[model samples]
Target chain A: MMDDIKELIEEGKFYFLNQKYNEALQYLNKALEKDPANIEVLYTIGIIYESINNPDKALEYFKKVIKIDPQHEDAIIHIHSISENQ
Target chain B: MERFVVIGLGRFGQSVAINLAKLNKNVIAIDKDPQKVEEIADFVFQAAACDATDEKNLRDLGLKNADVGVVSVGEDISSSILITLTLKEMGVKKIISKALSQVQGKVLIKVGADRVIYPERDMGERLAKRLSSPQLFDLIELTESHGILELLAPESFVGKRLDQLELRKKYDVTVIAVKRNVPKLKDDGSTSFKESMILSPGPDFEILLGDIMIILGKSKGLDKIKKVK
Candidate 1:
């Protein structure tokens, strides 16, 4: 199952790069189910959520990513952006 | 009431004169050099050679009667400040002075200049920025923290629609408009259609290939939004 989740994460990133946002979200979700604490996957999920106009969800994911990796530059930047803007 | 005077012909001076002229404002472009006045003759109602620091000549030009005045004496800091003070003494309604330094800026303001512009310093900063970030295309300052920008679409937003991207809600920005090159036909011979046209620009617009977008937002929000990609 862990092996499947890893494959799903790779597929999700590929879909994201291709701009297939919906397809990317499905794969990301599958990865999350297997390893819910995966910070990288959570950051990717935040990207998807922001892309889909879900600021609240995006902020939640970014917060989680920062909690796991406080020094994550992207998360720190986005958290400030989300809080200030929203 | 419509007439205005610009007393310098440097880059900053010329840009101001041209902008005012392009807006159909009645501008009088004056410079000490004959060549400077001649070059911008077409861009203004009148162009003449005049030393702006000369108080007598400023009064002769009816500085009090003119609606606005801009002192663009860019080369000589002393001359610019003296001209600004002279214009204020002439009781010009709006005296916009160009400053070469912070001290100059403060001096002009103290001399009763309605507004002070740091054109050289500002442009130097902008040029430095232009050299550093090749990815960043253009910037328009709305406030200290907020700005509008026309950036090359980021790698992350390549195929997303505005509604889907939800950038404004997430990042405090709105995509005001997009410029895309569609097949444009020239010299339409058909009477039915006199002009070539852009296609599929729906009211609910979708992002298309090679489209450059105009975005409005707080600068910090924009920086964050750019980072996610």
Candidate 2:
């Protein structure tokens, strides 16, 4: 099950790098289902949403990452940047 | 109006002081060169030929009461740094310094400069952006990933209404304004162009060819529109 989750995350990252956001979200969602509290997957999903100009969804995922691990620096920075603009 | 003290009489410093004065701000222009001071004496609220690095000279000019101070002596990095430090010590609330390099910029920030500007570097970035995207007339960066763009209307978007284009839903951008160039006959009977602007046109408004759109959106969304054929 762990190997399957890692494979899903790798696939999602590949699609994300290629700018195929919807496909990336599909794989990332699968990884989330396997590990509900995966901070890496949640952060990656937030980045994908941000790239697609969906700030609300991006903020949601990044906030989720912060909730799971309050020490998440990247997530905290993202939230600060987005909220500052708003 | 904010009180501004501009040090150094170089082109950059002179422009800053003159423009600030033109905006109705109380600007005190200072430099060591008497000729430079004389040239801008008529423009600013006060003009003086004094060493900006000397704390005594600056204190006599009441620099501590100025709301903002700009140190624009980039050619002489040492003098610029000293001036910046003097302004900070004199209780100036805001200090904007010009830096010749990244190292100087970091030093300025460490010495209490509120902002550091590299005119050459900034202009280079703007020129590169314009050269790469011919359609982009202007760009104002609001954040790292978002900005306001002025670009010519794409051929694909001609004759389409805002509602039909679905810009907000599809492209995730907003059209702030539209500028059209209209030809008018002068008194001597020669035709000249005049700009007509529409501020915040509604969804039913139609996009016309040759129109310039003022759009506000994330950089990704703007890039997507630029790629439209």
Regions of candidate 1 where Cα sits further than 4 Å from its true position? A1-86, B138-149, B163-174, B183-205, B216-221
Each prediction's TM-score versus the true structure: 0.59, 0.66
The DockQ-based CAPRI class assigned to model 2 is incorrect
TM-score of chain B of each: 0.77, 0.87
User: Which parts of model 2 have CA positions greater than 4 angstroms off?
Assistant: A1-86, B139-147, B163-166, B217-220
**Candidate 1 local lDDT, residue B150:** 62
Q: Each prediction's Cα RMSD? A: 15.5, 19.3
State interface RMSD in Å for all models.
Answer: 17.3, 21.2
lDDT of 1 by residue, B14-105 (tens): 88899999999989888999999899998888888888778887777676677788988875878888988887777777989888778888
| Number of clashes found in candidate 2 | 0
**What does candidate 2's lDDT look like per residue over B1-229, in tens digits?**
7899999889889999999988999999999999999999999999999888889999999877889999997599999999999899889999999998999999999998999999989878876876687577787889999999887888788779989989888779999999865433346432223558999989999876557889999999987887876
